[model samples]
Target: MSGEFDRVARLRAIFAGAHRGVILGIGDDAAILAGDVLATGAVLSTDAAIEDVHFRRAWIGQGVTWRDVAYRAAAAALSDLAAMGAEPRAMLTSWAFPRDVGDDVVDEIARGFRDAADVYGAPVIGGNLARAREIGLTTTVIGAAPARAPRRDGAQAGDVLWATGALGEAALGLAALEAGIAREPDAAAFVSRFVRPPSRIDAGRAAAQSAHAMIDVSDGLLQDLGHLCDASGVGARLDALAPTREADALARRLGVDARALLESGGDDYELLITAAPGVDLSRIAHPIGEITREPGIVGATTARTGFDHFG
Candidate 1:
């Protein structure tokens, strides 16, 4: 008798028979699962990181440590939970390492993950290890939210927009690391941003209570905010509150366009939120900009505008 088709068909068969609780099974950037008993409508999301694509060992050179890398990964995954206005509860981490790296490096990396998880009350549950030509980490995080989960599509016309914390420092830090410039103290702050990025879980939870919509600034702020506008069928207008001190100074130092950097730089991980015109934006500490009815447009007061991935 002829066996089944190839491996792909077998895998599809297995997937087709899987449980239906998988609200969003595979085939997207993240997988969303049904919540536990307490959180009947909770959602879980996960993402992975590969060596050359997500990061490079050469970027750290000799100063940064492996532990820092693990912390950064955990923080990044936690940020995804925050973007959805969910409270992170647990995480599963898997790693693949090359034989050349010592066990000590791996231990340090695990320690980093533990420390970061502890900071946010999200414990590491379990993971797997394997040999590979390079290092990789995949973190699966579970989070809890109310019945109606916040989504990228909740934004409305005339909703004011805002961002938490500063911008472009992380990108400038990456630039400095790549250029091997170790003199500026700001560079250290930037590198620290790269090593231990902060997730706006608190802000996300608060925004969910009132804000119309929200998203994390994983890509450039403008690009991600544009995502929210596109998903919600709206546009945006920047008010007086959207400049980063670091962007100006970095512009002077690198002779690069600060406006362009602010628009296109990635990895900030801050929350970009939108709400009605009358909402008290001051309630949230990091107020950045606002939303308007001019569809598909994001207008900034300064020369710096927005980012387009393919542009």
Candidate 2:
């Protein structure tokens, strides 16, 4: 057999005896797993960070540091657990790093991981290291949600959709970094967003009890919400008034297209949730819009609102 075919066969053979807890093993975008201990249900989620694509080492010029990247990666993974309305318990990180990177850089990255893990009481249990031309990080997080695990498919018609925290900040942060505007005062807020995104752990947990369906806003509000609608087989009508505060400010200050920024911007990592009609959900933080029955359609009050991955 050819080398490529032989490699596939070898991998399949290696994974053949993987245990029952393995929800999804090799040959998928991510591997899903369950725990050996019995419980209501288990949650498994994964996230990836790549050099140049997700971030650049050069961007940390001068006073900046690589430890920030480690913290961001850990938080990003935990955010997935939060979206499922689960509490993170453990994380397994895999790293690929270049040969030239010093040990101090690696140590700082580890420190970042430790700091973020401490924030949510989740600890890194195990991981693997490998050599590569560029740095890449992949973290798989495991969590548990008492009995009712919130799912992406649970949204219902007439449910209200909401997002926690401000939108487009992370995107704008990236913009600031790209423009080398880090010295500005406003840039600090954006830089904090880019370097350390707040994973809505507490907010997501609270929302889980009331939310019909939920997802973390990692890939921009519009695109991620589209995934929710697709999974739940429903449509959504976005209230233009909801996104106004952030969108308008971002538009005036940075010359960003408010609608496009809110819709398509990624890495906000806030919770995108759907709740039943008249659910008395005002107590929840950052309720953005409502869910409807128009399948495959997301209606925004204003034109040109929403995210397009390819656009």
- Per-prediction TM-score to the true structure, in the order listed: 0.81, 0.81
Of the candidates shown, which would achieve the greatest lDDT relative to the real structure?
Answer: 2
lDDT of the structure predicted as candidate 2: 0.72
Q: Each candidate's lDDT (Cα)?
A: 0.69, 0.72
Model 2's C-alpha root-mean-square deviation from the true structure amounts to 7.9
Give per-residue lDDT, candidate 1, residue 140. Answer: 85
Give the C-alpha miss distance for residue 146 in model 1, angstroms.
3.2
Give the Å shift of residue 25 in candidate 1.
Answer: 24
Task: Report the lDDT tens digits of candidate 2 across residue range 275-301.
Answer: 876666556555667777777555453
Query: Tens-digit lDDT track for model 1 on 74-183?
Result: 88889988888888776777778887776566667777887777777676654656778999999888777755456889888777777777766677766766667634
Q: Backbone clash tally for model 1? A: 2
Name the runs in model 2 displaced over 4 angstroms: 1-38, 62-64, 241-253, 296-311
